[model samples]
Target: MKEGPDIAQLGALIGDPARANMLTALMAGGALTASKLAAEAGVTVQTASSHLKKLESADLLIQRKQGRHRYFALADDDVGALLETMMGLAARRGLTRTRTGPKDPALRKARVCYNHLAGELGVALYDGLLASAMLDEVDGEPVLTEAGRERMMQFGIDLAALETQRRPLCRSCLDWSARRTHLAGSLGQTLLSRFESLGWARREAASRVVHFTERGETELLATFCRQDQNSHGNRSQRIMRDT
Candidate 1:
């Protein structure tokens, strides 16, 4: 009689090759039809139905109806974060699939983790913010500093409106590809959207890959790199005044 959580059962559900593949596809932060999931798993629709049933019953997935088709996605941000952490653990342990594709490098460079940017560029963004003291840690959680708010506002992000949303303003997510921590939460999502709107980057069609144009990459680098943070003396001056 186990009184604790049933981790073994959850492991069994996610350990299957087909189910794991299907779940990975949903990491792109899009709802996918059962048929599409089946294709991703390379299994028959009937088999996919059985797998999806187990996942849904365990509350690992949620269903959505669009038009005449039913789509499935990860239950929430927690689930996505868990999966990403697991992937990072696997990579750290040298347990990875041998068959790699052309898009692998691109994905490692920049991709969407659930809904926010992740990978090398994502890690860079997180690093830049921290190096610039734009974010501070409070009770182990990341908090947006006053300087961060100013910078974000100057970049055209509506902080006042975004703060009104129910979602958190800042969170740290583990980036599996880069094996580092990247930003997540309402703020992270908005920043990625801002990049797209500014034509700095674009998510690839039907894939998690994010492609930054040459100019966009250069701009992103200039913005997030620590060397460039020196130009922003206001933030440092303000911090000095407070300290």
Candidate 2:
């Protein structure tokens, strides 16, 4: 007899059209009420509640209570990653849904992946960090370099505080749209927060799209691209001296 984790069960749960819609709606990285999700799924509130319960039972969704209201969100980043990978595969195979919304272009440019950024901007950030030696590949995962730590601190990211968290400091997640890697894990989330705090970008309501002002994009490119050029040159000089 074969023995392994049951992928079939999970697939079945996600395969239902209504449930899929509900799950996709939660991908925006916000906890939503059942009524809101029901509208997204085009289902009745009672039906949405039942579907939510099933997802919660399957450990795909988590329930949060605030005051007198209950909201739902993706259980964790793993679930979000899996869904994004699936979407990427389907898109590549030409299995896209018939209708594309006006927000499609914006979504492909910059959108949220669970909490961190995903899309063209996301891939650019990952490449920038790698090219700059701010992040290094270690055992197939991203590890913050000494230079990365110092740079992040300069940007007001509290690396000391981040180290205290249970989650990993850095990770690389595959980008569905760009077919590249994007930063994930706690550090990724913190960076997104920093962008918002700086008034450089904001998440659109009812969507995963991250809208960056013209000034914001300019500042972002200035910060990251310059790091790439400077860090690479500095590292090369260090290597020459050591040799």
Candidate 3:
């Protein structure tokens, strides 16, 4: 017996075209109905249901029931993190699809990796937090600094409440587009949520892109300004280029 995890099995499960598409759709951090997921996968409802069963059986997805409707989401943040990393790997290897559109740039700028921000802006945010000493690495794992705690509270994020969640308070997720690390875990989710609530950004309908208004983008860049990363240019340049 191979006394190790079954990578081949997991790969086979996710390797299917329809299954991969369904999983990718769930990456937007929304629970999707089977029919909706079927549309995303370009497969029939029966096929989507069968695929969903396999995903759920493998624990890659978790089922949710609302009234008579059944919805499904990624099992947890770990699964999301894995998928994001795999995407980065795919991009790095030039294994990406040839299809291109305007949405590609938007997705590469600011999109949701599960429930938190990702892409160039996401990399920028992570860089900012580290540059400002708001987040630090203790031993090997990332940890929030005292300043980060105070800052989150001031920004209306309840750190104490976040700590009570099942997942860690802070963790770094690899951004697929940027090939760099970005925030994840409860704190990451809260930050994204706060951005939406404060009108700093809005998730596009049926898409993962999170578009920030002109003013909102300004404030966001100002809030997480990275003084040391001068070579990366400034907020104005990034927004102009992305838009």
- Steric clashes per prediction: 0, 0, 0
Q: TM-scores for all candidates? A: 0.89, 0.91, 0.93
Q: Name the TM-score of candidate 1.
A: 0.89
Per-residue CA lDDT of candidate 1, range 109-141, in tens? 889998899987887777778777888778867
Off by over 4 Å in 1: 226-243
Clashing pairs in 3: none
Q: lDDT by residue for model 2 over 142-188, one digit each (tens)?
A: 99999989889999999999899988899888887877678899999
Ranking by TM-score: 3, 2, 1
Worst 10 residues of 3 by lDDT: 231-240
Looking at model 2, the pairs that clash are none
lDDT of each: 0.85, 0.85, 0.87
Candidate 2 weakest ten by summed lDDT: 234-243
After the best TM-score superposition of candidate 1, give how far the Cα of residue 98 lies from its true spot, in angstroms: 1.1
